[model samples]
Target chain A: MFKVGITSLCLSVLLVTSINASTSGKLLLSGGVNQVEGSAGGGLTPWAFIGGYGTEDEIGANAFITNVKSSDYNMVSTGFVVGFYNRFEFSFAHQSFDTRDVGATLGLGQGYELKQNVFGAKVRLFGDGILEQGNLFPQISFGLQYKKHEQGRVVKSYGAKDDSGIDFYLNATKVILSESLLMNLTLRATKANQIGIMGFGGDRKNNYELMPEFSIGYLFTRKFIAGFEYRFKPNNLGVATEDDWLDVFGTYAFNKNFALTIAYAYLGNIVLKDKQSSLYTSLQVGF
Target chain B: MFKKYTVCLLLLISCASTDKLSTYHDFGEKKGIEKVVDDLFVYLLKDERTKESFQRLNLDKTKEGLSNFICVTLEGPCKYEGQSMKRAHKGQEITERQFYGMVENMQKAMNKNNIPQRAQNKLLGKLAAMHKDIIGN
Candidate 1:
């Protein structure tokens, strides 16, 4: 039932967003791609750009579906993003993570799935990465994400503090057009365990902690971009050691309305498993 | 966290590569710039992207002024001091889309003239910084 609703919603958005490219908005590549947390950015870091083509006057939107497969698990995410006047953004994502063999090892049945819903909002604060061109003022933004992780009992049994939480972040992005390079620095405060898949907080550390995320991208051409992202994670749970996340991704924008990305992700450790390297892919439609 | 800060500092330092534009003078000399100016005008006149903006302009005079302006901007021998972008674009509420259209046509012209991406981006960098002054209400 949930899948059907999301499918219809995605289809409706795709149908409605074929709107003409005649609006006053950014170019095809300016908006960036959707991150894991339903923000416009690289795979792991949320940059300062308000997602989509919306200018200071026009409204624009984007939708994304992502799949990630690792040695011990597989996950799928679907999200919708709305950019208002290129100044503020609202986004929603539903993520389902399947623990293939690992679930059975943890005394759960095989192929157990953990579900999460994330809602986020971001506001651009200052600077223009592109228009400023060579200047030093990077684009900056502030954002927050509320995450609800289902299966609270399962997480609490493992000594988690909460099943839901909010994440706050600030991102600074700069695009050096002459060299075709883009960079992002983000500071995030959170108490989530395994990015809220294993639930939020823990008995070991029940307070919010600060971590840094980094992303760097290079545009090989107007239509293609290659990038890397690293997200730092805090160790809070005695359930299993959590590792930092890293990914290298490449995106190709077919046009203003369609884009695709492929990536290699390293999650480090999870639930007695170590060094979980995986393949990640996402398909996005934006206008 | 300290490692992250160090890496960010390195990236910030690298962002100051603005001086790179001044070093590549051999790519387009005064003679080459004259031809580029001509080709740019031709492309603007014929290219579908920016042809609309060039329709009402005087091509010959535009060619001379643009050529001289670029020559001096690139530290070449020619001397051309045109009106500021705001003054020249006054009364015309040029959109950013139209500005980019013109830049794309110029890029095609530069590509055809074999002006390398480094030099091409250098030129576009200077022009892009004039976005606010050129695009107005």
Candidate 2:
């Protein structure tokens, strides 16, 4: 089912791009890069801006592949996102987590992989994050992500209550052109453990908890941006303590069609490992 | 050490005064504005995305009006005698893409004219306020 959905999504993007849409209007790097969950945003969190270079009269789409590797683990995420009329965005991402030596220590075998799929939808509520520099009002958006894990039985055995969950978030973003700064705040409510890669809920907590994510970026030039992101996570499982995520990242847009992002992320703890630091990199291509 | 601190303080004061210069001065005043306007016209005409809309207008008058408008926006001494944004774009049927395409041209022009990024942002901030009046009318 997931394969079919992804195939259709790719087909639709091709179908739409073959039409009369031309990409020549939006400012350089105004369209945010694809986030971890395929939403248009920073490395870790979604921002209010819809993905792509499409203005109000056009459709835009992006495809991205990202990899994060640490001493104990490796993760790969790839996805596509489409924006419609600058009002709505739909995205899909698939993540595969490889537990290297840690999996063997836990008796699961070396290179045990945990995979999950994320489907997201977002709507612009109001305001213009960019262009409206005359006011303090930020562009607001509401979004939701539904995640399903492939290792349902294994996660349940590890004290997770469910293998799937939903996350709802409200995002606010603003770009102060005069100061060359961009700020974003997102409040997400979810019951996912480790962003649903280890399944949803757990023996310790079954109720949804609200988490906050924030990012601040400075535009060094029209082509380059550097920023920091902090994402608070909920600790729901009794087996291991989950930790918040933080990253310092930089993005350089080669042009409207391609962008490269690299980040040094400190992922506090994932299951048995503590103090996991990783290098995260992503490449985005779009119209 | 005390003498060095005093000298540094004096230099800081002078730098503050330079920073206080208005965006118009940063733009190199009238000649700079004219150069930017001329380059802007060249880009708008050469670009396929914006050439059609610009081709229907009078090039010389449009250039003069844009220069005056930008001058006024940057708080220069010039007086603008052109039509209001709403009036000038009354039936142009400009889409959001076209509006941004023009902004792109202006940015390229400003870059070619050696305007500082901070000054360019101030100008863009002022002009962005006119977006509502110019788009989708």
Candidate 3:
């Protein structure tokens, strides 16, 4: 509890500092949809979709909502992000995982659910679009995330606890074909914490795992863009092991002030043992 | 496959190394305003500010237009359909010093390109006619 309080305080301070550092100029707003397949990292089953909006340039702010579905469970998540000087960004997300009819079969009655919260911060050490030429490398950013989980007693009986841990990652992005094509490659590492709803286990030693991701996009015109992303993660949960996923997406800019994105993901099941797949979609809007 | 990929890669690499415009275009035609403008560009490259401005321009298209404009202005066999100097440069706040610096650079570029002084003077005379519109009092 005290740890959570301290984390919240740190996030507040960081946000305040970033806001003050922002120089008044022009502001840009953007939004997009993201989908995830398979049980990437945590054990929340193999399905989910995320939608979000962001304001950027000197200062930044973003908000998102996510939903995941499985044979016996379902989860919904909401997240927020803010940044300053385009150098540092902070984010917060909360998730609710529900154990449907399976809860009754397990003698816990129906409508049981688990909840998890995540807080993250990212800082850019080098790279800028305005400062660098086309021949130079793109921007790189380093980030950290802390997650905590909680659940109802019936769900807790399955050995769930309020677990907390940290994760770190590095991301690189570039606009290779300026006005036509854009590409991004991200490499991330995180301590194996429980999947969002499942608490981090007390027995396993916290280990760093690499999560590499790639995205390629083409802008058909100033108003439309299509892209895809692939991500890899480790199986941290004992319930079901998961594999990587591929996401295909498209975005349309309504005008200078509004845009929308949609995506479909093919999840590759969990535990490498069972082959389960799912689809995900998201909608985003921004100034 | 490796050989094919290597050949493609070399093609792209060579394309990257090639200049955006040919030297002949930079030097302008053998006799006319194209020659004069080429001279001016060479001269302008010497001054830091004018050079910076020139570098900022989209070199390929701008150079083409300049070549034609100079030829037409020098009584050569060409018509310049682009915007006049004054109308084109309005709101840019270009100063007399900057203009003169540009002219001197043009002279130098002509000399470097082997254009004779007589031809340089002939082109300069026509360039002078647009000063009123370009400088705007």
- DockQ category of candidate 1: acceptable
What interface RMSD do all candidates show, one decimal each?
2.3, 1.4, 18.6
Per-residue lDDT for A30-148 in model 2, tens only?
76998888899999999999888888888887788888897689988888888898899999999988988988998889989899999999999998888788887999999999999
Using TM-score as the measure, name the better of candidate 1 and candidate 2: 2
- Mind giving the per-residue lDDT tens digits that candidate 3 earns over B13-111? 996565533222333543544555655666666666478668778766777788777665544556678887877788776654455556556656676
Mind sharing the TM-score for model 2?
0.91
Best by DockQ: 2
TM-score of chain B of each: 0.76, 0.85, 0.66
| DockQ values per model | 0.37, 0.64, 0.03
Residue A223 of model 2, lDDT score: 79
Clashes of each: 0, 0, 8
The alpha-carbon lDDT assigned to residue B7 of candidate 1 equals 97
Write the residue-wise lDDT of candidate 3 on A1-287 in tens digits: 32443364356445645554332222111122322211111112111101122212244343334455544455566555555545565667676656677567656578556566777666666764222333437666666667776553432344433366566666665544323445666666754433444454322334667777777776554356677877675555555555676667666755322334555655565322244343343322221
Instruction: List residue ranges in candidate 3 displaced over 4 A.
Output: A1-57, A68-73, A102-111, A129-133, A152-162, A193-195, A201-205, A255-258, A270-276, A285-287, B1-137
Instruction: Quote model 3's TM-score.
Output: 0.53
Cα displacement (angstroms), candidate 2, residue B114, comes to 3.0
Give every collision pair in model 3: A42-A195, A241-A271, B33-B70, B39-B106, B39-B110, B40-B106, B43-B105, B44-B105
Instruction: Report, to 2 decimal places, the DockQ of model 3.
Output: 0.03
